[model samples]
Target: MSSVNYYSPEGLQKLKDELQDLKIRGRAKAAEDLREARDKGDLSENAEYDAAKDAQGLLELKISKLEEIVGNARVLDETNLDLTKVLIMSKVKLKNLKNNMVLDYLLVAEEEANLAAGKISVKSPIGKGLLGKKAGDTAEIIVPAGKLQFEILEISR
Candidate 1:
């Protein structure tokens, strides 16, 4: 089964760009490495050639995986965002029920999620719990530590 993931227009473009880079620059670099390794001598015991071939294989696998992600990515239009509830691409302000600490986060795709930027993946425990919730609603998220209760303070596009 394939996991359906959402992506903003910008995010999708980034994926395309990365794919292009891998197909072009990455392929060229791998070819150069392979050529240099082949010049080093015997194929049976050439560690450099083996390593280079392995790297090429891994690079190709990465490229294919990235292509699959791009092919399945759905771009979400922000102009039509429904602010009545929390959903993908929604920026939410939440308060911890126990500590009263407020936090802001943008719920996005797994690929776009960045904890340092306060962006959470829609598949994350907190994001999943927050989905479809409205302001004043409480979300019960199950994390590695335990159940975390958060009050939805605000929701925005």
Candidate 2:
């Protein structure tokens, strides 16, 4: 019932690396912390012990999420992509119809989205609305503020 998500090669690799780190180094760190806390004695009253256990639980949750993402992740081969329509990893340039302002954003997964880097999540309202659009197309996206019109100026790999 889980849908597969498309990720760029770099994004997929990053997820794999983080998952490995959490399974290896993260587990080791948690064990060490727990052992050290146990050495301090008084289990029920030991704040350090409680903290370590809480951390371990959080780490396990993170590892579980990483496993799920990796399980459903697919790498997008840029060349094989259809350039005629917008999709994940496509660099889209658009003009704000209201202000005639131009903005360029690369559609990416939520984990890889970084506004400072011009990467926007495909889950975002604007990105979702822009999906499957071509250059010279106009997309009207509904945001928390209201609907905004964006004219696609360019689409590139």
Weakest lDDT window of 10 consecutive positions for candidate 1:
1-10
For model 1, residues 96-140, the per-residue Cα lDDT tens digits are 998999999999999889999999999989989999999999999
lDDT of 2 by residue, 1-157 (tens): 5678989888999999999999999999999999999999899899999999999999999999999999999887777789978899999999999999999999999889999999999999988999999999999999999989999999998
Task: Quote the positional error of residue 141 for candidate 1 in Å.
Answer: 0.7
Q: How close is candidate 1 to the true structure, as a TM-score?
A: 0.95
lDDT of 1: 0.92
**Against the true structure, candidate 2 has what lDDT?**
0.94
Question: Residue pairs in steric clash, candidate 1?
Answer: none
Clashing pairs in 2: none
> CA RMSD for every model?
1.2, 1.3
Q: Give Cα-based local distance difference scores for all models.
A: 0.92, 0.94
